[model samples]
Target: MLPRVLAIAGSDSGGGAGIQADIKTITLLGAYAATAVTAITVQNSLGVAAVHLVPPDIVAAQVRAVLTDIGADAVKIGMLGHDATIDAVADALADFAGPVVLDPVMVAKGGAFLLAPEAVGLLSARLLPMAAVVTPNVPELEALAGTQVEDEADLLLAAQELLESGARAVLAKGGHLPGDGDEVVDWLASHEGNRRFASPRMATRHTHGTGCTLASAVAAGLAKGLPLERAVAEARAYVAGALAHAPGLGAGHGPLGHGWTLASG
Candidate 1:
């Protein structure tokens, strides 16, 4: 039987991030993909222009429909845009006994805010506690932890704070840390222990859907029964491969080659 991963996120018109990226990453990783779209984004590789949120009840219904029917082994959540939607998702997932990978998608690559500021608190209160692992980039980590992250030590501290807050594990990404180094390090911290995964930063402007891709990849791994550390390691490798094989579409940040494995084989 194929592993099933339910992706709850927004729709990206440009197909670079959000539900589109999640589906692509999940399907490519050999997991069945399902989605409950929370918003519709007018966006391209350049930036997000506008957003239209889906009704909260509709989002909840979509989740319930999938959960009660096709089912899921894991869930990957991203870009819930509104407080009501967060509440809806929390309620819908109340009894879903599967691992969840939460990607706190706050800002688009073009500097547009994807998540409403008021909804942040609600998400932290409702969703963070349920996540098996929360993936937060530097800025999102700072916002969630309510602190500044100037160094790797700060990154670990903030991740620890999140673990204390509710998350079973936190993948604190240090790609945006102030440094001139050629490598990016992401820290995966859980109550059990901590480990670092580092990849040499590839020089490219085509990393549009990286966060979504990584979270979905991790969810796929979890759905396939890999442990957290192994799942994260594989996800990082997959994202690195995608980045290296970016399609270079559009003028600004371009989309990654999520279908790289197809071509590689």
Candidate 2:
């Protein structure tokens, strides 16, 4: 049977992030993709124009409907735009035992706030502990940890604190770190230890959906039974490939070439 991953996220009409990106990344990696859209954003590669949030009950219903019918091997969560939506999703997945990859999507590629301010605490409190691995970029890490992250060392330390708080594992992404270095490092911090996945940074405006794509890739890996470290490594590599092959569509930050593997294969 093909591995199934349920993505509980918003709808990016742009087809480059949120549920769209999750579906693309999961399917390209040979997994079945399911979704419970929490919000619908009027956006393209340029930026988010307006957002219409789906009701919390509907969001929860979508999740329950998928889980009870198709079933999922893993779950990837993003862009719960409201506090009530966070509560709804957390309650819906209370019994799920499979790996859950939590991408604390606080902001979009264009600086639009995806997650609501009041809901941040609720997500950390309710969902962080339940996640098998939580992927956070440097800025999101600073917000979640409620402290400043000056360097890679601080990034690692903050990730460890998240483990102490309740997370099973933390994939601390250094892509947003304060640097123009040749390589970007992502650290996987868990109770066992920390491992780093480093790759050359590509200079491009076509990384619009990289965060959503990477988290979904990781979830797809977990659904296929890869270990946490292996999943992170593969997902990073996949994102890199997509970045390198971006078609450069929009005037602003563009979408990744999520189906690049199809051509190569």
Candidate 3:
């Protein structure tokens, strides 16, 4: 049977990230995708113009409806816009029997804040504890851990701290690390140990929705029963390929070609 995965996230009208990215990632990886939209964002490749949050109760109802019937094998959460929504989602998934991939989506590709400052506290205290794995890019990691990550060593330490704070695992992405080097490295820290995934840095500015895509891909692997480390390994490869073959769309930071097919097949 195909693995079933649910996404609790906001809707990106631009279709590059949030619910749109989750759906694309899950479907492309041979999983069934379900959704409960937490907010609606008026956004594009350039920036986010506005965000309309869904009622907390309504969001909970959607999650309940999906869990009671379809029963997801894994859940991916992104772009939660408020504290109430985060609380509602936490409550809804309290007894979930599947892995949860939390993408701490604090800001948009254009540097617009997607998560409110108040919501961060709720997310760290409640949602982070429940996540099977939390994926935080540089800025999000800094916000959650309350410290700057200057190098790979700091990234590992931050991930360890995040795990100590209750996340089962953490992926501290290194995309924001400055340098004109040949490789980009992402640190994966878990209860088991720390490992890294490295890829040659592509010089493309079209990296919108990368965080959303990576988290959802991890969720897809977990839904299909891959172990955490293996799931992350596959997800990283997928994201790299997506970035390498991005379909040059919008003028500003464009989106990955999530549907890009392998030539071997």
Which of candidates 2 and 3 is the stronger one according to TM-score? 2
Per-prediction TM-score to the true structure, in the order listed: 0.99, 0.99, 0.97
lDDT of 3 by residue, 83-165 (tens): 88899999999999789999999888897888998789889999898889999988899889888988877888888988888
| Candidate 3 residue spans exceeding 4 A from truth | 262-264
Q: Which candidate number maximizes lDDT?
A: 1
If candidate 1 were superposed on the true structure by all CA atoms, what would the RMSD be? 0.6
Prediction RMSDs, each to the true structure: 0.6, 0.7, 1.2
lDDT value, candidate 2, whole model? 0.93
* lDDT (0 to 1) per candidate: 0.95, 0.93, 0.90
TM-score for predicted model 1 compared with the true structure: 0.99
- lDDT score for candidate 3 against the true structure: 0.90
Where does model 1 exceed 4 Å of error? none
